[model samples]
Target: MPQNDRHKEREIPIEFDFYNTLESLPVDNRCTIIMISCGSTTVKINEHIQTVTAPAVLCISQYDNFQCLERTHLSAKVFHFDPWYIKACLNFENLDDSVPIDKQYVYDRNMLYMFTKHHGYFQGIFNLTPQQYIRLNELMLMIGAETYAQSDDYWTCRIRRMLRQALNCIYDIYVDQCKLNFYELSENSNPVTICTDYIHANYRNNISLNFLCELVHLNRTTLNQRFKQQLNCTCIEYLLHYRLKISQELLSNTNLKIDDIANQCGFKYGSYFNRQFTKYLGISPSEFRKNPTGYSVKESRGKP
Candidate 1:
């Protein structure tokens, strides 16, 4: 595959390929990034098998480990690149060239760490938002364009840079990176911290007070107490705020319909989402999206 692209002997050995079929791509020591467009289907990556919803990404680094068990209404794009593509692309570090490719992640901190989050076993799936879906799909096209055209002396660099962004975007899709501090928490994290991290990661899911209790191994009263003491709100209230916080961003930034935004934020029903949003922010989502500054003009949001 690398032969198809502009191959300067000095440039890092990386190949780019695009496939429309939902089946797996063969990777010999290379990392394959599979971009599954907006649709739902069941697929097996190694021993892990689950129904993957639309607009998701899967990064696989093993050979002969991917199979499409079911491909109902599936569309995808796949990119294959050498595992050392990033490490070799680096000229700034005076590091040892003899470092083994598999262990190269030890020297590379963040980039590879994202891929090797669960070492040994392959982690092959990441959830993506609709906005993220559009951005990543575009990035794939750009990577293909640069690799095919060999636009300039820096085409490889451009692909590498955008590749980094795409990787980060899909992996960090649900994670609120602002909550990275949660990662520093000890294995025995406090109930509030555990609950907050779970909420942040699964805000779009059908999360509940009982689910939080089971996740943190605490009773409902104690869990609510911990959240109230630390955040001055109950667990459910915190979840609502997090969802609305996400809704606020989507409303202000994207041209998505209010109903679609509400559903994506886990509101089950659009009317309830509308009522709660209006009650909390003292304005309808449509009104807020239209004039975000309207909230400040109101004397009080809680009042009539």
Candidate 2:
């Protein structure tokens, strides 16, 4: 990785036939960064695998332990996500680890296949051909950049909403082109659809187990078990994490007072909000605002 702007911007170059294993990971506390792979590289993490082609921005957070299982022919450019530079509410400190093709997400092969088939179109987007996975990394960078560049809170929020909608369109194209493998597992009923709506509808309020049970028509036991089994986390965990993520975006992008942000993110009291933010993110809201460029977390706790 090429380090520029004093750890604020970086570039990684991966060459063909290159292989490396990060058996012992580094312990550096820095802000989250965007990586632009310059060439074909295969990355493996336990059973999960990512084969990169074309130039793609790989977002790495301070919260992640990137135990690189294996890699091949990897080269890329990397840049840092400084909250002050971008002026967004998103905390680059937390990273999202949800598997892309799981129940809560719709897998689209069209988007993947398009990149794989016509590698040229995405060549400019990524430095690394034969592009297999395209949307996730690219979209991440797009949102990151847009959030950083836009100052208007309303426009920033609107842009993120549209970006999500665009992601849905990409998913549609992907589903139309390639058959989703996970759909079969959820044939009897699509739990994700119901649960997604429930969370989105009532996330701002105090969403409890009984409430979710009544809303989804599932018992507490079943809901708990299936939620963890399918989505890899409990419902409440997901809700809090999601709320915090949105709050981060709001904090960096808007001039809303801390109390108002707390209320907007479903926290009744600003003190509780401060505690939660500090507990999960290592830094208080005030400190984060003061030095948006500082991206390291004191301890690991939450995901973005």
Q: Name the best candidate (by TM-score).
A: 1
Residue-level lDDT tens digits of model 1 in 158-252: 99898877777755652553255433443324677656766665577787788678656679999888877777778898888888888888988
Ten consecutive residues with minimal summed lDDT in candidate 2? Answer: 12-21
Off by over 4 Å in 1: 4-12, 22-26, 89-109, 117-122, 174-304
Shift in Å, residue 189, candidate 1: 21
Clashes of 2: 33
| Model 2 ranges off by over 4 Å | 1-189, 293-304
RMSD of 2: 21.9
The C-alpha RMSD in Å for every predicted model, in order, reads 11.1, 21.9
The TM-score measured for candidate 1 stands at 0.48
TM-score of every prediction relative to native: 0.48, 0.36
